[model samples]
Target chain A: MFDIAAVAVTIAIMITMYRAIKGPTIYDRVLAGNAIGTKTVILLVLIGFVHDRPHFLDLAVVYPLINFIATIAFLKYREMGRLD
Target chain B: MIDVMLLLIIVVCAIFALFMKDLLSATIILGIYSFIMATIFTRLNAVDVAFTEASVGAGITSVLMIAALSRTKRYEYHYTKLQRRKPSALFLKVISLLLVIITGAVLVYGTIDMPEFGDPEAPANKHVSPRYIAESEHETSEKNIVTAVLAGYRGYDTLGETTVIFTAGICVILLLRRRINT
Candidate 1:
């Protein structure tokens, strides 16, 4: 059951990757990349469980924090055309 | 039965995400995919991992993507063959495909030797992992084992990770910021 869900998520990620690669605009690629990052967090958590490690949740928490910061930074960069 | 169902859903969502023409829709679908994965983690008895996934994957990642999209165009332009095609592109694609296949094969081969899912006696359980699980609560006074591992035994690594994030944030700001008179 869980495996099926994971597989679905993987497929979704692949799709997102395609968009990232083929996206006509930079924003589209960014969107796809962001989607991939989001999926990655969940994938990491699922992997931890499959491995039977409940402790992996800490990684999940940290991953989002970092991912968000990175995204915001990129957005700001794109908006201002410079990183001040 | 449930696992099979989950797998099927995963496959379907993946296909949809891949084929979707609208970038926004695809991005949203990917978010859903992350949430489902988190649920699966919970089902697998990895509460810690599930928690992190829900927070980071569903929350932060989506926000960043949307922010990025808001600053740029939503749709991608498809180029027809008539526009222009470089023959070298075919070679690049073929090379990329080969690279992908080789990477995938290596990953699968590595998995083949892994202990069956949920095997108790696996080395992972027999080694420092067991010690960490057993003693983390007492040592850190933190109920969550994941937290203990991240902040305790691997404190240096966590610090490094945090530093990296901070650096990335700074770099982005520096790159994006407009010139100030000062």
Candidate 2:
């Protein structure tokens, strides 16, 4: 069951990778990158299920926590050109 | 089957990243590659490695690359005729291509003798990992084997990783902080 979800997400990741690579604008790439990050968080959890290793769920917990910070930092830097 | 599919996609992403003219798009594609690779690592039961790859490869590296791109040219442009005529540059490119091909061939050849995936009798699985798995709960009182190994038996390595992250945080502060009076 979870394997199906993982395969679906994997398909989504491939589609987003296409956009990330072939997108015409910088914003399109950024959006694709953000989408990939979110899907990665879900994929991480689904993978834990597929492997029957729930102990690794803590790792998935960290993905959403850090991925947003990365996406926001990228957008922030793009807008202001500085970290501060 | 899924692992093979993921591996193929990862290779495609890496090739596209190499061929991209826009540095920003390349960085983004590389992030996707990292994410998928982390997924593969998770599938292989290397949860600690996957965790580190997710945090460092997909998150920190993507952030660092974007920060770097903001300070540099967005596009990777071809050199002007004068710059392109430099013999040293052309020589370096030829040397790099040869080196890369040689190294890749060696690595591929090395994989031919590798044990099948998750082979229970593999030397890597035969060694200390089983002991760690058996003793970790009793020794560290931790339910997670990875956490137990990292934070208990290999505490020094985890300490070093923490120190590195701390140093990076400090460097970011030093570089990005603005003085009130200045």
Candidate 3:
């Protein structure tokens, strides 16, 4: 069932949180952050099913788009040391 | 069950982020916290709020924090023994601890009178929300009630949000373009 799947994903999120907080390097944290963002998109879609509201997919779609942008920005800033 | 678990993880993330000495790691932990919170909002049927939180919290806020961090030190400064021994620092720490405790106690006290979560007859649910839910489809023809309420009934608020984002983009452009020119 979707509820069971959601609980699993929730556990996965907690695992990623541990990695993000305990990472030894900046790149490790960024990778964990990206992984968390991806999992959130999955959680959002699963939530829509659990709530029986398919329209929530619109929000899910927007989340990944923004997540990608944020990840790219983070990486770019880290490498260049300046956004410009 | 999942909700309770999610809430517990959120608290753990918050505490971990607070104790992190690496600024980037802290920001990433905070982003995970935001992501989980957005999921919780969706579970609570506040899809609009979830959408905003996902975009602003996990996305824009992380990006902004990283950008700011790039301009500053990546690691938090550790006080040397001489600095830690300063009486002024000790006094400031004690005063801040007291202020935090007082503020926390007041906030906890204020929550005692709040209506239970998702109470149908609570003042908020009894107010214009009912009308919005009842008439959103007919008035706005949007399948998502949240979208209808946000883009139709609350046009000015959406406009303000858009304007704010636009202004932020303009400011970033201005600040960054000059560096390229120079």
Query: Largest TM-score belongs to which candidate?
Result: 3
Candidates 1 and 2, the one with greater DockQ: 2
Cα lDDT of model 2 by residue, B1-182, tens digit: 67877998899998999999888778778877888888888888877688678777776777777777777788898889888779998999999999999999999999999999888989889998899989999999999987898899999999999997787656544544554645
Docking level of model 3: medium
iRMSD value for model 2: 2.7
Evaluating just chain A, the predictions reach TM-scores of: 0.87, 0.83, 0.92
Could you estimate the TM-score for every candidate?
A: 0.55, 0.83, 0.87
What fraction of the correct interface contacts does each predicted structure contain? 0.14, 0.73, 0.80
Question: Model 2, DockQ value?
Answer: 0.61
Question: For candidate 3, lDDT tens digit of each residue in B21-124?
Answer: 88777887878788889888888887767877877787777777877888888899999999998999999999999999999999999999999998888999
Question: Residue B144, candidate 3: how far off, in angstroms?
Answer: 6.6
* Clash pairs for candidate 3: none
Scored against the true structure, residue A69 in model 2 reaches a CA lDDT of 56
Q: What is the lDDT of residue A50 in candidate 2?
A: 76
* Pairs of residues clashing in candidate 2: none
Per DockQ, the best of the predicted structures is 3
